[model samples]
Each structure stands twice: as C-alpha cells, then as structure tokens.
Target: MENLSTIERILAAKQSLPGALLPILHDIQDALGYIPPDAVPSIARALNLSRAEVHGVITYYHYFRQTPPGRHVVRVCRAEACQSVGCEALATHVQSALACEFHATSADGDLTLEAVYCLGHCAVGPNIQIDETTLHARMTPEKFDRLLAELRSKP
Candidate 1:
C-alpha cells in the first residue's frame, strides 16, 4: 500500500539519525496526520526497537495521534494558568458547542478538540490554538462560537 511505501521511505531516511525515534514519529505524523498502526512493524524493525517500544513512545506523547484528525484541530490550554482564567468553563463550552470531547473528532468530522498543557502564552491565559497556527487569548464562549462560525464558512 502507499502508506507502507511512505512509511518505508521515512524509516529509511531517518533511521540513521541519533535519537531517531521521536523525530521519526514526528515526521510520520506530520506527513500522515496520524501514525498508521500497520506502519508500526516497519518502524520498529527499522529502529531496531520492538513494537511495544514503538507503541510506547507514541502513547507517551500527548502530541502523537493514532488515528486521522478532523479537518480542523482546536486546542484549548488547560494548565493551571489557563484554569485560573476560567479555561475550564471555556473547555466545557467547546465540548458542548462541537458535541465533541478532547481527543475526539466532532460528529461531522469538521473539528477535533484537544487539551494542550500550555501554549507558552500563559500570561494571557485561557488561550486557544486553531489548527496549530492561530492563537487566541482571553477567550470566551461567544468568541469561540464566532471563530467556529468563521471556520465553518470557509471551504
């Protein structure tokens, strides 16, 4: 399959690097949106690690996803800083609004909502990241809906 070919290429390309597991996983995730379970054997063989090791690495990191993501990814900060600023309320709103919970895609598969520990913008707190690019701070339910509307409007 094409996924195997791509995975083989990535394994061949990065297998020689020092401390290659994390980078290899990152590259695969970047290219495929999520790491295919079938690719684990090839990756483990290339890295000279067991499938358990490979799977462990993937599971250890919050950033790694085992399945395909939705068209859009929405990450809301949940660190203590964000919590102080009412991020819990914001998170509740998001889950209710999208009818999706953290680490799960919406029913229509339009969006994925996740909880990120921190966005490094803790001073502002209550921050949200859209598709890992745009960052919004001091968010509220109203602002979230407006942003969601805008995203839905786009093709």
Candidate 2:
C-alpha cells in the first residue's frame, strides 16, 4: 500500500462530478494503483455522500481494486466476440505461462492479470490492453509471452 498521505492528496483534488461516482473512482484509481479503505470516509465527506454510499460505489465497480497492483496490469478481453475467436485458450495459456490466476500477480510482482469485457476491437478479436495501451488484433499466446518478456526487460 502507498502512504495514506498520498490518498489525502488525491482526495483534495475535488475531482468528482455531480451525481457521477465513476469518474471520481477512476481518478482515484488512476492516481493510486488501488483504492485504500481509508478513502471511503474521505470520499464521502468530499462528495457530500454517506460512507455507505461511497463504499457501495467502490464495491460496485469491477475496475476498482482494493489492494496494490503489480507494476503492470494486463487486461485480456473476454467478451463474446473475443471468446468466439479463442480468447479462453489464450487466457489459459497466459495464466499457465505466468503461473498466476486471473486477477493475480506474478511472483516477481511485475504483472497482474485481469479479464475485461471488451476493448472495442472485436474486429481484431481477442484484443489485450497492457497498462493504458491497447494491442489490437494479435493476442496469440506466443505473442503475449513475447510481450511479457519485453515488459520484463524494461527497468
């Protein structure tokens, strides 16, 4: 976990939109790798929402993480289109290669795997987004492994 003071800095941003919980959550997650439990009260106070309301919002979003993430987050598309193109097998191969289950991080703490509903690249099918960049069309297991190796090589 990052220092709680970091979260306090984020809360001070006052970035939430009226009646829009998602943007606030996104900003928080973007600033901090994950949402800290202590943020619930702070967010509630800032947004003029109840603690339960803030907590509910956090729990409702699958994009939110309660724990720190690995240095890189790998999201594999698992929507119907991606699955139709063999994403399941690709996902299984990635899990096996990394020795980490979905939503789990590698032992080296370099990668975290997650399943995403879609990347809006169905035409490419079986797309993957590594961190903020989307890799379109070519998400074969072999390619994924190579990409991982490339990411590992970086300092």
Query: What is the C-alpha lDDT profile of model 2 across 43-74, one tens digit per residue?
Result: 78877889999888788888899888999999
Q: Alpha carbon lDDT of residue 124, candidate 1? A: 90
Which regions of candidate 1 fall more than 4 Å away from where they truly are? none
**lDDT (Cα, tens digit) per residue for candidate 1, span 1-155:** 88888888898899999999999999889888899999899999998999999999999999999999999999999999999999999999999999988989999999999999999999997999998689999999999999999999899
- When superposed on Cα atoms, how far off is each prediction in RMSD? 1.0, 2.1
Q: What is the lDDT of every predicted structure here?
A: 0.93, 0.83
Error of 2 at 30 (Å): 0.8
Q: What TM-score would you give candidate 2 relative to the actual structure?
A: 0.88
Reference-based lDDT, residue 12, model 1: 88
Give the lDDT of residue 130 in candidate 2.
Answer: 88
Give the number of the best model, judged by TM-score.
Answer: 1
